[model samples]
Target chain A: MWMGQSSVDFIMAGCKLLDEGNVQSFLDNTDIVLTDCDGVLWRGNQVIPGAQETIEKLRKLGKKVLFVTNNSTKTRAEYVTKCASLGFPASEDEIISSSYVTAHYLKYIVKYTGKVYTVGPQGLAQELNAVGIPNFGTGPDVAENWKFEDYTTLPLDPEVNCVVVGFDKDFSYVKLCRATAYLRDKGCLFVATNTDTGLPVNGRFIPGTGTIVAAVSEAAERRPDIICGKPHLPIFDTVLKLHNVDPKRCIMIGDRLNTDIELAHNCGLGAALLVLTGCATLEEVRQKQSSNSIADQRLVPNFYLPSLAQLGTLIDSLK
Target chain B: MWMGQSSVDFIMAGCKLLDEGNVQSFLDNTDIVLTDCDGVLWRGNQVIPGAQETIEKLRKLGKKVLFVTNNSTKTRAEYVTKCASLGFPASEDEIISSSYVTAHYLKYIVKYTGKVYTVGPQGLAQELNAVGIPNFGTGPDVAENWKFEDYTTLPLDPEVNCVVVGFDKDFSYVKLCRATAYLRDKGCLFVATNTDTGLPVNGRFIPGTGTIVAAVSEAAERRPDIICGKPHLPIFDTVLKLHNVDPKRCIMIGDRLNTDIELAHNCGLGAALLVLTGCATLEEVRQKQSSNSIADQRLVPNFYLPSLAQLGTLIDSLK
Candidate 1:
């Protein structure tokens, strides 16, 4: 079966059993591979067993690889350091993150010149600063208690014409006030890093960047002008442009159905392989695939394995 | 015509012109008058022109007057002090506020025994304390930067079974984490003061209590169980019970259609008179009334005037 052209409704019918022959055929048909970081590669800090070996083996087989992530809490340099320390060393150019993509979009695509009012952590600020984009409202607290006079004299920076929101731990009423006022002008561009409602940490989910973005959007009464994250095309388009890769020869491997699988679908990638190592459970995949509902079709994976390690073992046996 | 029973679609059709005859007729039909503080009586510290005189004249004409406010940043006592200093002296018992209503709900209605986790300022905490509801997570810097281990070690008060959200100047990431964790327990009650998206300050809008509430709600992935503000039954119920007034003889006067006028509509009050001083404009009101949408019906005021001063003039001439 030409699994790449098969509809999501036919995904279950075309499920390739991970025999050595099936694995070798799937591997030979792909030239470029994109992978998600947190779930498919590592749970929290520790890397998944054999995930590193599989990527390296893929590289040895002449396949191009890229690490695409939604975590905007760290700079690309920090991610590079983290990869190297975890025994999966990667170059800065090989990593595409929401934080990095936001900077890239602001600089190259939008050609923005004004200061950004960022409702995020220092990491996002550092990325913007690295691209020579001046930003405000990111660091330590400067907002005081609101008094009667504060109504007339709330501090505002007029130079801010862009507001970028991410996973902001330092989000305050003052920052919210400033961003809302700036957005009221409508000339200001509103951008968000990702829309992951909650993030997994230590086997549990906590509030994520999407929560912060939702708050700003609700208060401003305006949806984001651009959202650079999974299930969106900006980051994937950036990665494709940087690597100069053909979309038809690329496959995305991730553990999330909504973000990873749907991202590949949105980007016109060849296929998406779900590894049962993160948020989606096997029962959920079964429910989506067997259903005749067209809306649920987008969430069905092109292929799924019990774990990335199982795929790694299959590929190793082929070698 | 009895405007209280008039169709919302016919609100503008029955609107009283600011003539001596029309104004006198509107005054003659009401025994209790309820007014919003911020936009109707005053705009930030400076009382609106003729507002105080209008209230004094209403009282002289033997109308039972009460001040209703959504500002949860201060206690009823503080509001009394501010009102006294601003030329419109009001007693503590005559003022109904969101903070007061929230406290009353928790203490009397729910009879909550556990401590509260408050994501608000000193005023909300003080009101909760006055009602003997012990609360934590207010009025200081307790939340620190989240470390990786914070996922497991975030400080949480075991006794906190309710989370009250309002306009908190001291809100931070640590508080968000704590609240999210507490809410995940499922037994905890989530409450908010109001959901007004923004508040006008010195002719400009700033992010208000709704902004803060939205942030917490998004992060928690839960909606507030109780929102004790204008147009909501809790605050109005508290005011009605405290004053022992007849709803059918009451009239609500204010500038905002969505909040003040809707509050009267929701309470089954006798009439709603819109003043052209605050958020809603004539064009917007006319559009809402003219539309066939049922949702817009609650927002249409029974009558409208140029200002409270016009109503004051009508009453003085009657005297």
Candidate 2:
């Protein structure tokens, strides 16, 4: 009945939340578990040796496990593709990206029935249209080119409702000129997908959407109107609703301390399990748990794990 | 009746182009005609020294005149409004602003179907939309509220095909971020209405859209998609078409030597004017002419007068 055994068990068994009493109560009450990707399951590409098996083991014990990510550029489909390619079993609904949250937020404000310009990929644009926010040019063989300066000359036309910023490399003088011009005249809205600084692929660092977002910030003289992913609304709430469990009864788990741990704490969900992989290194977790913390202390993970597979009896004992 | 004394008549009567050439040939032959607005009979107020009436004088006498200016933000409509208000009897088609030329050039290479975000007043944005471009959001509402960075993340989207740059003093961090982010996105284009470094209002200097555009460029790492306005095209071409005449017979009559003179030279019409009223002074014109002689020689006027009212005798002599 133990299902499997590995070094992951010792890590989980010895886990201690900073507020031990609160964590214990949380463990006793929660029926659902939310997990962050990257650090929890793998580092760069080599899975933490037993992540998949540990997840499978946890599921067999009747604990609902979920995964979340803050990277906004990739769509749910893209995330699914990545997971599948990474040899993980994932369904579209099982994963979330910042882009998803952004789309949902826009829907709350108004439907974009006009043009939308971005420093992002096709995925982010597709998300907007998917939610009834019609794109600027939606017809076949539609050929249109515009410069930033053109916006200033024609601000009230109502053809453009929003400006979505994501990751882009083609930033240039011409585009900036036109975009800012429009900003001053019509007062177009601004929204950012996510704030990840960089993404690791093939053992190298590639610029993330955050860098692009920051660049826009430097020009526009402000930050995102709203950030759609991580520690924001709906992502955590949606997951809780799906399982019919209260947030207080849910245990959020993830590899990155910042996204997973912070999200869980911000939403009143209990306990974050820090795994060493993805964006944050093990050394970083130790650093935060020790003095130089920019974040609030209550958000710290309840438990620490070298690998989920490193836990054995704790899986059974927790139940 | 000779409005001016017979003494002025000989000077006006003996004018070479009117006496020896036909309208088309004379227009083609004359390099430039400079005039003033005050004494000229404009639509009403004060075409001032030689503004509109001077152009009328040149037309009957077979001289070519090019209108120019230093006020970069005003669109052709604004110019038309001023001319009409001043009783200049000119169409929006006849007058030119640095803004008009800026918008004109942007329309040429860029293709866009979405809403353009703009900063300046209605004249600028309206001018662009009239030619078939659209803009995002409207006055003090969305475009004003949304910063450039937020443009990427929200429901509106980041795949902006183009951005139009203009001036806005309240421009904040959010707008800069959105624009910067949008520009970095691949394939998005940028444009500026004008490259004015600063704006003059109430005797104080403020950074113009050019400064903001440059900031965006540095962040995004590219040059302007295009700079419209001032000696640029599609503007001059539009003006020529308004007269229902060929370019060989068209002229630009403006107050500023650089904008008017340079505009004419660039368009293959002719550059010839300077007034103490605009940004470039007579001293500046003289220095510029001597320094860059190609367009510089053309900068000198065939006719230099204190005002246009002195042309009555000259006008009758043409008959």
In candidate 1, stretches whose alpha carbon ends up further than 4 angstroms from where it belongs are A1-25, A151-155, A287-295, A317-319, B1-25, B142-145
The sequence of per-residue lDDT tens digits that candidate 1 reaches over residues A82-154 is: 8888877899988888999999889988899999989987778889999999987776563565564564466
DockQ top scorer: 1
The Cα error of candidate 1 at residue B212, in Å, is 1.1
Write the residue-wise lDDT of candidate 2 on B1-319 in tens digits.
1112322322222212122233344344554442323223332242455445545666666554444443444566677666667655555554555555555555553445555665443556666776767664222222334222334454435435676666543333334455555666657777766555543333323345566565556556677776665545545654554445444334444444544545555665532333344345556555654564544554543233333443433454454
Count backbone overlaps in model 2. Answer: 155
Provide TM-scores for the models: 0.93, 0.46
Tens digits of per-residue lDDT, candidate 1, B116-216, equal 99988778998999999999777655336556556556667888899998877776666777778888777899999888888877777777788777777
Quote model 2's TM-score. Answer: 0.46
